[model samples]
Target: MKQLRANREKGMTLVELLAALVLVSLVVILINSVFLFTEKNADSLSKETDVQQNLLLGMKVLTKDVRSTDGEQVTVEKNRLLLGSDEYAAKNGQLLKNGQPVAGDIQSFEVCRPPKGAVYREDELACKPLIAGEADENRIIVILEGTANRAGKSRRLSAMINMER
Candidate 1:
């Protein structure tokens, strides 16, 4: 009887083996779920596409406005730009040109004149009037900043426009 008892103790019970198997399976399932959840949340490619689309739409409109402008009395501002008769501004989650919303999901539009007064020309130095009473300028950089509506990814795009008379 003692020998038989020792042999039984050396072998694992059926219940013990089943319980171990169940625990391992459960642990594997839990780990897989965690990884899937993390991957879903961290997906950034879709967000990048959204931001790119917004940028393209905004840039298209801005390009047309910049190109069609008469290029006379150009005015550059932080949030607004005046080229010929067309005007662009950043307002209310949209890009506005001539008081009409041209692009949506745009957070900001900036029209900056690079400080090239010394480089552009001595007379046109750094925000100084090119010619008193004359507002026509040469070139400017337009920047559009936006975010994806769903993913919330923020991006910026810029273009340099050489004003033509």
Candidate 2:
């Protein structure tokens, strides 16, 4: 029987092992940093998307309501909008529709009379936006302006609706 003799010691040396460990740690650290940055970016993007969706939903609801009712039925007060039996108001930094919360983080909600080029005043509220030209009186249109915010950023929404009695 022939036996093989060991030529030299095998396996990784201490320095080689240490170098491998350092390389692995660096890769791990880089991956961790990238994931951390991605997480932060995703969080911010989620907040922004939420605010935008809320603003769009709010505008849609307002438009539907305005279109269903005549201008004479909707009243624009200081910080509230009355549409027939329903009311949309801003209170406690929230927007409410008929006393129920419809949106959050609302900075402002206003009803504007574009034809008059002015916001509706509590004392000067009108059924139809006063226009200089002699236009159709059967249809009246109004504007709803709103602002929604999340974190430190904000978004604005504007909707114009025309109603015919």
Collision count for each candidate, in order? 1, 0
Error of 1 at 13 (Å): 7.6
Report, for every candidate in turn, its global Cα lDDT versus the true structure: 0.72, 0.64
| Poorly placed runs, candidate 1 (over 4 Å) | 1-35, 38-43, 116-136, 148-153
In candidate 2, where is summed lDDT lowest over 10 consecutive residues?
136-145
Model 1, 77-112: lDDT tens per residue? Answer: 878888777778878888888889877778777776
Model 1 deviation from native, Cα RMSD in Å: 6.2
Cα displacement (angstroms), candidate 1, residue 46, comes to 0.9
Q: Pick the candidate with the highest lDDT.
A: 1
- TM-scores for all candidates? 0.61, 0.68
| Predicted structure 1: clash tally | 1
- The collision pairs in model 1 are 117-125
Candidate that would win on TM-score: 2
